[model samples]
Target: MRQALVVRGGWDGHQPVEATDLFLPFLKDHDFEVRVTDSPSVYADPAVMGGVDLILQCMTMSTITAEEVAGLVAAVEAGTGLAGWHGGICDAYRASADYLQLVGGQFAAHASRYAPGERSGEQADNYVPHRIEITAGDHEITRGIADFELETEQYWVLTDDYNEVLATTTTATRSWGAWQRPVTCPAVWTRQWGAGRVFVATPGHRVEVLQDLNVRTIVERGLLWAAR
Candidate 1:
């Protein structure tokens, strides 16, 4: 059986528990021997990671030691698939450049949705309307999915050209924002690192976003696509 590891923790605002919970049954149904943990340190355990076939992580704004990062990267390079969504994967390990390089993208900020007269933005301000456009419908993970819209956290991510961008979302200039031009960022992307594959989705700030038909379907397919 293929082994699947889910490491989830960090800011509860992202709803890590309930979010990862949504996918547990899917993983089990696929014949994966699943293991769940609350820490990324588990990556450092060779006895555990060496035999793992896939790693699905959701911990955001957390830190990983050099040893742990090294182990995680090594496992991926050796063909272990890595997959995640939203801040859990992209916004995670802000302090680890190695981790950022592995994922091929970093969470920059959400387009601030300001109130009628409010100068400072609130948490809810990050919840803005956006659309995810399928850029590569022929790709295995996104072949049947169409472009979709969502009123959730629209991530403005810093991404490199290394990713096989499957989908994207464009952010328009908001009155309360400082930037003047419209921006387009990857909403779903896959990267190949050595023998391993990496998948990331910029949506899923809350559990509801993950529950979206298009979002959920793509993420589900991405897991299988990334697995070794």
Candidate 2:
């Protein structure tokens, strides 16, 4: 059986614990023995991550020690799969340049507005009807998932050139703001790091958002596809 370590708890707004809970059963269903921890123990012990097959991290906007970052990068380079959604993986450790490099993208901010008067400067609680266009239809992560609409926050990312973009969405148009030159952004992508895999989706802002059938299916498929 494959082993997976889930380290959660950084920002409650992303519902790290709750969002992780939604996906835990799926990993187990695939015959992975999942272990959930909060102390960052796996970071300290190289042996603890030695045989782990996958890592489902839900931590957001926090600082991870250098040792922790090295351990994670080493684990993945040694063949463990790494995957997560929203800020849990990409935007989690802002201060750690190495972490951002490994993930291939960093959450810059939530841009554009969902509707009139709905634009809050906040990344959380901003909801809108965004379409996730299937960019690379031949990729395994998005193979069967067609172009679909998601009513969630459209994330803007600062990315590296390596992502195999599978899906994207246009930035919401605003009437008040008049600086536009055709806005489009990556909503889902997969990248390879060493022998490991990294899958990212930008639509999952709230637990309720993922409840949408298409959203759930996209993320669920992403999880399985990202696993080694």
Candidate 3:
């Protein structure tokens, strides 16, 4: 059986725990021997990481030690697939450029309405409705998936040319006024890192956002496609 590691824990606002809860069962049902951890320290253990076929990480904006980052990178370079969504993967380990380079992008900002210190009811009001368009419809990760709409954070990411962009979302002018002149950005992308594959999606800030049928399907397929 394939071994999968899911490391969760970061900014609570991203709901890393809840997000992992939504997908762990799916991984298990797919015949993976899944291991769960809330700490990044596990990445430092070469013995542990060497056995992992897939690393499904959900750490957002957290710090990772040099040893941990090196072990994780080496494992992926040796053919262990790495996958995740939202800030958890793409926006994690802000201090580590090596991590961002491996992931192929970093979260620069989000198109949100809620300003600092502003609260709308219980929610912070960072969501904006947007459309996700399939760019590489023939790719395994996005095959048969059509353009879909969702109300979520439209991530403005700093990406590299190495990504095989499968889907994208455009920023609405209404959301950012002059700043949002329909700037199209990659919503889903895959990349090759040494012998491993890296998969990422930017629409999964909240559980409900990921619960979108199309979104869930794309993510599920991405995980499988990235796995070794």
Best model number under TM-score: 1
Return whichever of 1 and 2 wins on lDDT. Answer: 1
For 1-228, candidate 3 gives per-residue lDDT tens digits of 899999999989889999988988999999999999999999999999999999999999899999999999999999999999999998889999888899999988766665445646444476777789999999988888899988778898889899999998887655334573667889999999999999999989888888989989988998898888
- Model 1: weakest 10-residue lDDT segment is 114-123
**What is the lDDT of every predicted structure here?**
0.92, 0.80, 0.88
Model 2 weakest 10-residue run by lDDT? 111-120
TM-score of each model, paired residue for residue: 0.97, 0.90, 0.93
lDDT measured at residue 166 in model 3 versus the true structure, 0 to 100: 92
Model 3 residue-pair collision total: 0
Judging by TM-score, tell me the better candidate of 1 and 3.
1
Two-way lDDT contest, 2 vs 3, winner: 3
What is the full ranking by lDDT, best candidate first? 1, 3, 2
